[model samples]
Target: MLFAAGCLAILLGITHSILGEVLVFKRLRENSIIPNLTGHKFNLRQIRILWVSWHLVTLFGWALGILLFLLADVNNAPATLITQLKQVIAIAMCGGATLVLLGTKAKHPGWIVLLSIAILVWFT
Candidate 1:
């Protein structure tokens, strides 16, 4: 179950990044949906920052999935370290779920997978 959660997380990250880029970011750019973070002179910079920030979430998720994969295999790993990793991953997953749920007003399906991963990590 834990390993499956890890695989799900990695898959989610990959799909999120790719689909978001193609469906969300590309449309935003093409439709000139750039927000005015700074003055009008730095519109491209703001868009770039938003683009990077979006992908950073994916990168963090990938890292968590990698950690989960490692944890699933390390039979002789330290108990304290394992506990700490589990705690961190659960908290992170829950936090991410909350953010996505609230930010998208429960419209985004990403929250479901994130919350599921959190539950798996918590019980595993």
Candidate 2:
């Protein structure tokens, strides 16, 4: 279950990035819908920053998933390390879920998978 949760987290990260690119950013780009943070050329800087920030979430999730996967495969790991991993992963997942839920008013599906991952890690 822990491995599966890790896999799901990875999958979710990939899906989130792809969907955001195709469904959100593409349309925004096509329509020139990015908000202007500065008066002139500096507005492009805002777009670039926003783009990087958007993808950073995906990268962070990927890192967490990779850590979970690697830890799941560890043999004879110390109980303290396992306990710490469980706590960290579970807390991160729950925090991410809460953020998504509140940030998007539950419109985004990421919260569901995130909460599911947290539950799996908790039970494992």
Q: Write the per-residue lDDT of candidate 2 for residues 1-124, one digit (tens) a residue.
A: 7688889989998999888778756644543434223433445454544554466588668768866776787573688667777867787777777766654446567779989998999889
How does model 2 fare in lDDT? 0.68
- lDDT against the true structure, per candidate, is 0.71, 0.68
* Model 2 clashes, total count: 0
Q: Candidate 1's error at 26, in angstroms?
A: 2.5
Where does candidate 2 clash, by residue pair? none
- For each candidate in turn, give its C-alpha RMSD to the true structure in angstroms: 9.4, 9.7
Query: Lowest-scoring 10 consecutive residues by lDDT in candidate 2?
Result: 31-40
lDDT of 1 by residue, 33-82 (tens): 33223444455455555555576588678768877776787574698667
